[model samples]
Structures are given as structure tokens and as C-alpha cells.
Target: MIALDSIIGTLNLDDEQKFITYLQKKNKRKDAKNIDLFKLLSKSTLDSKAICNQLYQTKNSNAYHALRKRLFQSLIDFTANKNLEDENSIDMQIIKYILASRTFLIQKNYQVAYKILDKAEYLADENLLYPILNEIYHTKIQYAPNYPKINLEDLIRKQKENQNKHQLEDQLNIVYAKLKTVLNSISHESKIINFEIELNDILKSTDIELNESLSFKSLYQILAIANISALVTNRYYEIESFVLKSYEILKRKKETNKQLYYQIYISYIIANTLFRNKKFTSSLNYLKEMEDLMLLKKGVYFKEFILKKTLVEALNHNYTDNQDKAISLAETILKKKHNDIESLLDLHLSLLMFYFQKGQLLKAKSVLSKFYHTDQWYIEKASIDWVIKKNVAEILLYIELESDALLISRLRSFKRSYSNYLKQIGQTRILKFLNLAEKIYKNHNYLTSKTFKTDVEEAFERNTANKEDIFVISFYAWLKQKINKGDLYKTTLKLIQKQ
Candidate 1:
């Protein structure tokens, strides 16, 4: 059953009263039982038994259930009618007028029908609703015999123009949808290698010509695809170029239905690119811009943008060795409520990494504890890559705490599980890091011995040269710090800054 609060919230007090009046009028009764029940439930403090007794003079479960169902159905009907009355979409209004015109024609009211049809045609043409315009043209052609003022040839030509425009828009929308699906599916770093190839294939198959004649929708789609592809491939420079170009286009176009989205997307791409390039201060500036853009639009997408902005800011702080700032931002994210399970899981993993980087083993373990107890439903909802990162964080925590026995056991389990998983997914870099970390842990004492400092240096040089190994969790920096007896955080910050 729909919650009483949801129904009440959807309709304000005035609307709820209006709906009740509508129910009474529809049922042809001055005293509607459902109205009494709705008023009782709106208070929301009374128990079901009290409401049932008050309405029916008895505490009967079956009667309460029946009344609840009836109220729910009435609410649905009221909402539908209210929406129909309040709708403002030009396309939908055009369709409504066309239907009304057809009804009038059926009633032999030719003058009224033609007047309504003319209004619909004007609305459709003004809004560039080509499909609706075609419908209006067809309606005009069908009734042209009754109205000698109508020019059949002119109507046919207009219909052909609208049909061509409709076909073009449909093709662009199809390409946009396909690209959006591909972007969603290939979000992980491991899957990024195929992103460019997949995008190229899509472009080839669609045969879309990106030229001056392309519509804003097509331009937005192209920018989105390029932005996501750059992110996946870690091509920050390429993303920066796209961001600058898209920003110019958006500024030139002024406000549109997707203006806010484009603004947020460009800001996020710029911020993330700076972050990846180790320009933390510059990245923070762009992130602040993203936050301000988010404020202009208050909705679910806005909330999502805020979460993303916070996550990027936290990473920036963490990479710059500002542990306190990172921890503060991460804590704020954790305190807030989120409906997006994937984002929540990502925040948890990031927070855990921040605590680990700060050498606060206990705090890191606490973060992992929260992760461990994540709802099974949330676990299922999380991406496979995120879950793998969580597992890696857990292993890292065990190693940091020097829990040798537990670390060894967990490493063995992780090897068997993740080796096959990563191998199958072709994430060989992560697999290599896992294997290397296990080997280092087993020979920890030997590696730290005075005579083996050269060995550690050699290991660092080998891992750093590969590029892929350094991309995975800074294991090379950790080895360098251990070998030189320097601060791990300082070494990590320096290494990243150098990059």
C-alpha cells in the first residue's frame, strides 16, 4: 500500500481538500467514508484502529484495509486529473488540442474544429514539435473537404518538412541513447581501454556527421561521450580540451533544458582533470564552481553532483597530504544520507583509504567495519570494481596493522578469489600489485634489514618504470618510504606531485 505521508505530501492541504471535494462530486454523495479516512490519516498520529473505529464505529482490520485501498485509488485518480489539468508541455498541449478538434469534427462542429486545429498548428510550429505538427497537418488534410479555405498542397508540403525534421531528431536521439548506455557500462578504470574503440564503433555505425548543422542535443551527446571516454582512459589533457570547448558552446547557447547539466558536467571534468594532474588547489576552485552550479538546480541530480564534488575534493586533499581536510570532507559525506548505493560505497572506500593514508589504523579499521556491515542489498547494488576496491582496502588495513597471521590468511584467500577475477577481467595491473604486496609483506623484515636497502630501491625502480604498477594505490611510494626510512605520506605526496 502507498504510504499515507507520500500521498499527503504529493498533494498540499488545498489540493488534498480539492481532491476530497472531487471524490464527493464523483461519487454523488455528500458524505464520503473515504474522505473521513483521508482526513484521519493526514493527521498521521492516530492508530489504524482508532481511525477505523472513528470512521466505521468498529476496530475491524478488513474494513480498514478496504478503506485504505479505496483512498489510495481515489488519490491516484485525483493526481492523474490534476496533472492533466496542470500540464504545460507544448507538445502535449498540441496533442490535446488536436484530439479536441477531432472530437468537435465528429460532433459536426466544423467551425470550432478548424479554430482548434489552427491553434494546435501554431503551438506545434512555435515549439518545433515536428511530429505533432505532422499530426496537425494530417488532421487539416482529413477535414480539408469541409473547409474550402484550407490549401491541401500547402498542408502536404508542411507535413513532409516536419516528417524529415522528426526523422533527423529521432536518429540523433538514438545515437545519444546508445552512447549513454555505453558510458554507464564502461565506467570502471579497467574497462576504459575499450572505451575509445567502442565509441568509435558506435560513431561509425550511426554515421553521425558532427558539423555546424548539428543540433544542441547532438553536440551535448558528443561532448558527453568524449568526456567519459577521457575519464576512463585517464587522459586529463584531452578532457580539459573538451571541457573548454563545451563551456564555450554552452555559454553561446545560453540557458537550455540541459544547460545546468552541461555546466555541472564541464565543471566536474575540469576539477577531476586537475585532481588527476595533482593540481589540488586548482581542482578545489573548479569543485567550488560545481557546487555553485548545483545550487542553481535543486533536485536528485543536484544532490548527486554535490556528492561527486565532495568525493573529488576529499581525494584532492588526501593527495596533497592534507589529512585533516580529507577526513573532515569524508566525515561530512558519511554523515549525510544518500539514496545512491554506488556513490555511498565509493565514499566508504575513499574514506577508508584516507584514514589508512593518515596512518590511523584504528580509524581505518572503523571505516572498514562500516563497509563490512553494508546491507546485503547495497552490496548487490554496488559495482564489481567498487567491491574489489573495498576488498583491497581491507587487505591493506590488515597489512598496516601488522596482523601477520590474519594478513597472510586473508592474502591467500584474496589471491585465490581476486587473481581469477582480475585475470578474467584483464586487470593485470591490479593483480600484479596484489601479488607484489603479498610478496613484500611476507619478506617485510628482510626488506627492512640494513643490508637489503638496495634491494628495496631496486624494487621501487622496477615497479615505477612499468607505469601501470604505479597507477595502482601507490605501492611503489610505500616501498620507497620504507627503503629510505622517510615519512610514507610525504613520499606519496612528492611522488604524486612529480607526476
Candidate 2:
């Protein structure tokens, strides 16, 4: 049986009271069992036995369960009805208008039916609800024989225009879907290397023409595909042209549901592009713009944008040497609820890194403890790159703790888990760094030796030159500080300030 608390939690206080009142009115009983059950389950802590005893005068599990099922069904019905009344769907409005027109037509109320049809047509055309417009056109034609005032030629012309728009929308959606799917599947190094070529191939195969008259949805899709491609291919500079074009289109378009969504998405893309290009201040500005746009229209996709904005802001603060701000933002994100497991894992990893960088060993350890408990779940749910990052973070944490035994054990386990995989992904430099760190930790006597220091410095130089490992967290910088006998936090802060 579903938990009573869970069902109650899905609703607001207003909705709960409405449901309770609905049940009371429907039952017309002085003491309705379902209403009583709802009140009891609404409590923070629910004791099924006590509820059963109070309601049935006996502690009966079967009776309590039966009442719960009835209450759950009633809640579902109430919610469903409420949702239907609260829906703001343009397509639904079109259907309602069309059905009303049909009813009026059946009663031979030609004037009222035509007026309703006119409203439906206007709503459909305004929203570009082409599929529903097709239905509207069919209804128009069906009633045309009954009313000669309905011009068949005009209706046919409108149908053709809508059909062409629908086709264009379909093509754009297909290209967008393919680009997203392929981009998501690009985990291997080889795929990343050839990402641009693959993206071009997808665009070519889709045969979508990018012209000035392109619809807002098409333009947004183009920007989205380009943004993702630039991100994965490390070509941040390529995104500016697309961003400019999208902005130009958005400026020309009037405010609509599609325009609002496109604006939010484009703002996010601009922020991400600036972030990737190391323009942290500018990126934060764009992020604020995105947040403002998001606030203007809190759509169903609001939480996704919120998470993205939060993560980017945290990263910007972290990279700008604002550790306190970074730590605060990341911690706030960890507290917020998220539906996606991968996002939660990413936030946890980011929070752990922030605490470690700030020298908050206790907070870092607390985050690490949580990470370890959830590591297996993450590994099962996330990408290989995510797993690699987590392993590297764990190794770094162990090193910081200065527990040689645990560090050694972790190093060995990391190698066994990822050494071969790193080589496959052209990240052998990471493996080399891990091996070097393991050797230094094992031979504690040589940690301060000139020879060991030179070796560490040389390894850092090699890894730094690779550039591929630059994005894989700055283990090289950590090694550099270790060899130079400088504080990791101070050294990192100095480097960030220079950036």
C-alpha cells in the first residue's frame, strides 16, 4: 500500500482541505470514515494501529488498509478533477471550443457554432497548434455543406498553410531529438574527438534548412544542438554566432509560450558558453538573466533550469576563489530536492570538492561519508566519466587525511578499477599521476627529498601539457603545491585569482 503521508504530501493545504470538504459533502454522513482517515493521515506521524482502534473501536489492520484504499481513491479523483479545471493547455482549449461548436451545430445553431469555430481557429493559429488546427479544418469542412457561408476555398488554403508549418516543426523536432540522443551517447574519447563531424552528419541527414524565416522552435533547436556540440567538442568559440542568431530571432518574435521557453534555454546556453570560455563574471550575468526569465514564467521545466543555474553558479564561485560562496551555494543545492539521481550525485561530488578546497576537513569528510554510501548507486546510474571523477576525488580526500594505510588501499583499488579504462579514454596521464602519488605516499622518507620533489614537478609539467586532463579536476595543481611545500588552498586561490 502507498504511504498515506506520500499521498497527502503531493497536495497543498488548500487542495487537501478541498478534498476533505469534497468527501464530507459527497458522503453526507455526520462522521465520514474517509474524512476522518484523511485528518488522521495528515498528521506528520501516522500510527495505523491507533487510527484503526480509534475508527473501528478495534486495532484491525484489514479495516485500516481498506479505509486507506478508499481514501487514496478519493484523493486521486479529487486531484484529477482539480487538475482538469486548472489546466492551461492551449490544445485543450482548442478541443473544448471545437467540441462546443460541434454541439451547437447539432442543434442547428449556425451563428453560435460559427462564432465558436472562429475562436477555436484563432486560438489554434496563434499558438501554431497545427495538428489541432487540422482537426479544426476537418470540422469546418464537415459543416461547410450545411452552411454555404463557410467558404471551402478559404478553409482549404488555411489547411495547406498549417500543414506546411506542421511539416517544418516535425523536421526540426526530429533533428533536435537525434542530436540530443547522439550527444548523450558520446562517452568514448573517440566520439568526443569526432563530435563535430558526427553532428554535421546528423544535420545533413535531417535536411533542415536554417533560414531567416525559421520558426522560433526551430531556431531554439538549432541553438541547443550547436551549444551541446560546442561543449562536447571543446569549441566554445563556435557558439557565439549561434547565440547571436538565436537572440536576433527572439527579438523579432512576439511573446508566446514557445518564445518564453526559447528565451530561457538560450540564456542558459549563453551562460554555459561564457562559463566554458572562462568568462566567469559574464557567465554569472547571463545566469542571472536566466534566473530572471525563469521567475517571469515558472513553467513545468522550472526545476531543471534551477538546477542548471545553481550548478553553474557554484562552479563559477569555486573557480573565482570564492570558496565560501561556492560552499554555501553547493550546500544549498544539496539540501534542495531533485528528481534526477545523476544530478544529485553531481551536486554531492561538487559539494565534497568545495569543502575539501576550503580546508573544512570535517565537512569534507561528512560529504565524503555520504558519497561513499551513495557511490554504488551513482556508479550504477551515471556515466563512466562521473565514476572516474568520483574515484579521483576519493583518492584526493584520502591523501589529504594523511592516512597512509587507507591511501595505499584506495590507490590500489582505484588502479584496479580505472587504470585500463583511463588508457582506453586517452587519459593515461591520470593513471601516471595516481601511480606517482601512490609511490610517494608509500615511500614517506622521500616526500621531501630533492629527487622526489623534481619527479613530482616533472610529472605535473607532463600532465599540465596534456590539456585533456585540465578538465578532469586539477590533480596536477595539487601535486605542484605538494612538491613546492605550499598550502593547497592558498596555491589554488592564487591560481584562480590570476585567472
Candidate 3:
């Protein structure tokens, strides 16, 4: 026992090291089984992320990246190999690819993502690729359909092809110009215009089938080729009568894949025209229908645009009373920014009017705080949106019997600042905004109402008389009329007369 203890305690460093080396050598000699066990890890773990992490942690970079790639390959292989009961199961690979592409897009590695997405797209024969492909196409469509590298051989061939394309394009263009020329041509009779005559013949014979037989690209070429198009030249009833024929035929013929999409744009255009004419209710209904059919989140070009549309729709849907969803939707927009100066200002002023009318001063103050973020918020940048809030506030202020001094002062000061900005921009015509606001603030029911009504008659009367004015004028004229008949105008008149 004494001899053993002394040997252990007083062992030399070399002996101790030699002893450890002997043990390590013995341990290293025998583990084909453990290597086999490690090999089995490829089957043991199906979690792609976990496998990737483990591989990296174990100093296997090549294996880690390989496994990462195999995850996608595995999904596609599974979809291909397995006899799946669910279509969604087959689409799992597509989902993975799309999500991965989005991740790369979010990382701003566009080329890599685009290449990967293209591969994914080729693998996919489904229509789900349309939205993705459309986005990818748009990223470069302005400069060229496909670019960054154009084949010299193809370029030479295309230049030769372009010679023929130019001839065809030029002929279509000449015909198209003839249609445009008809709009400026003075005509009192609906059935007697030169443009209408040409348009009638085209409508009678040409259709998707006839156009196809002539090797033309559907409505696009015919729309391009017609010497005189009726859309611009005809006024409300006449244009509607012509357009409705096409619209009815299109609606009844059983829609193709993209027909619904065309309808969405058409509805949007019609809604825009109606909104221009101050047909807010009609516009709201049209927009609601279009939105119901739109691509939802997938179609949102930007967060701001979508939010603004939703906010306006929410506002436009209700009359006399403000909806709570407008505020919530606005708040949703605000959370995406570091206060979101533009949206906050819009929401603030909207509430300032809505809450002030409802007599909820506290709520109005809370809403106005959102607009305080911008040091110099420019209304021109947000012209149409700013107009809605400012005008609405003026309407409320004019009508409210219990108008707060602070609120009136702030709104009036804003109007003044906006007027100066308008002057500076050499858009003195926009000074009408101040004039309208003044009437609203002063509760000039008759004057504002008169202006508003005339605005509508000008904007909405279908340009039957060939009088084309802008949307703002029509919008303002309509609002003025509303104020005159509104309870606000009545209340204001009572107060003014008493004074």
C-alpha cells in the first residue's frame, strides 16, 4: 500500500504523459462501430435545421451546407417519390422553395434568390408561380424583358426581327392615333362621329376568335389597331353602351385564367372615375367588389398603399359616423415605422375631426400625437390622402358647436401652412383647398354647397359636352354640396344668424 501511494504521488511528468498516450492509443484502435454509429446520424435525424446545426458544431461545414441543400432536394424527391393523397403535400416542396426564395429576397440577395426561384419555378408547373414570376419580371421589365446579358447572336436576329416588328407596330400605332384624334374632334351628335363609325365596325366583327384567326394578340392588337376607338371619344351613355357590350360578352363567355384579373383593373379604373366625380358611395361599392376579388396580401404593392386603401375604404363605407376599424388599420400601418410620419399625420387629422364631432377630445389628442413625429411633413407628397383628413376636419369644425380653441387654431394654422406650400410649389390652383377649408370652418353652407355641387356636375357628367376637368375639382364641388345640406351646415347657420 505504501509503495503504490508513493509511486502514484511521485510519478514523473514523462511517465504520466506516456500512460495517457498509451490509453488514448488503445481507445483509438477499436471503434469501427462508433464510426458506423456516426454514419447512422444521416438517418437518425430528419430535422434539417438540427442536422445542419449538429454538423456545423461538429466541424463539418461541407456536410452542413450539403445537408442544407438536400433538405430542399429531399422535399422535392419526397413529393416526386411518394404517392401523396393531398395536393398540399405535393405542394410542400413548392412552399419550401417559395419561403427560401423569400428569405433570400429579404436578405437582399436578389440574383441568387431569383436564380433559385427560377429553378423552383421550372420544377413547378402550377399557376402558383404566376405571382412570383410576375414580381421577378417586373423587377427588370422596365429596362428590358430579360437583360444584364443579351446574346449577341440573338440581338442581331432580334434587330432583324425588329424591322418587321416596327412595321406592324407602326401600322397599329397609326390606327391608334386615329382613335386618339377623335377625342379632340368636336362633335354634337353621338351616332355621327367618324371615330364611332370605325369603332362600330371593329366591335361588330372583331373579337377574341376573329383576332386570333388574323394572328393578332387578342384585344390588345385590336385595341391598338382600331383607327378610331370609342372609349375616349364618347361621353357617359355612349361609352358605357359600347363598353358594356364588351363587358357583357366578356362576363358571359366564361372567364379565362387572366380575365378576372382584367376585370379587377377595369373595376379599379371605373371606381377611380367615380371617385373623381365625387360618387364616394358608388366608388366605395366598386372598390369593395374589386378588393374582394383582388389577390389580398399577395397583391399589395406596398404596405403604405394597401393601408391607405383600406383606411379610405373604411372611411368611405360609413357616412355621418366614423368606424373604429379605420383607427385600428391606421395603427397597424404605424407599427411598421419608427412612428410612420405620413400615415400618423393622416390618422391624426382624421381622428381630430371624427373624435371632435363625437365629442371625444381625449381620443382626438391621443390620435394627434402620432402626427408629431415628422419635423416638416409635406402634404403635397401625400396630396390626395392629406386632402381627405384636412377637408374632413374642416367639415367637423364648421359644424361643431363646441369647437375647442386649440383644435381650431391647429387646423387653421395647418391650412395656412399648406396654402403657403401650395404657393411655393407654383400650384396656386391648390389654394382652393384653403378656400374650401375656410368655408367649412366658417360654416358657409350655401357657398360651399354650391361649389361642391358644381364640382360634381363638372366632373361626373361624362364629359358629354367635351368639358374635361381634373378629379380634385369634382371631389371638392361634391363635398361643398354635402356640407350645405348636412346638419353641420344647419347648426352653423343657426349660430351665425344668432350672432
The best candidate in terms of lDDT: 2
Better of 1 and 3 by TM-score: 1
Where does candidate 3 have its weakest 10-residue lDDT segment? 210-219
The lDDT for every candidate, in the order shown, is 0.69, 0.72, 0.43
Q: Write the per-residue lDDT of candidate 3 for residues 1-499, one digit (tens) a residue.
A: 1122222233234433443443344344452122222233323543434544554556565665554343334334433443243323425665576678677766766667667655655544233233343443333232233335424465345344434444444454455555544433422111134555665554453223322112122233443332123233212323333332443454454333343334555555445444433345776887776676565435432232444455455444323133455555555555543223444455556546445534465666566544443323333334333543455454344444445575466556656645554454334444554455445556656454666556544433333222232223323433434544445323322322222
Alpha-carbon lDDT of model 3 = 0.43
Off by over 4 Å in 2: 1-87, 107-111, 141-157, 175-204, 212-244, 256-262, 297-304, 336-340, 372-376, 380-382, 444-473, 487-490, 493-499
Residue-level error in angstroms, candidate 1, position 197: 4.4
Off by over 4 Å in 1: 1-197, 211-220, 227-240, 256-259, 277-282, 297-301, 373-380, 404-406, 424-426, 449-475
For each candidate, give its TM-score against the true structure.
Answer: 0.67, 0.77, 0.36
Model 3 regions lying over 4 Å from their true place:
1-256, 259-269, 280-285, 295-309, 319-353, 356-362, 378-417, 420-486, 489-499
Which of the numbered candidates is closest to the native, going by highest TM-score? Answer: 2
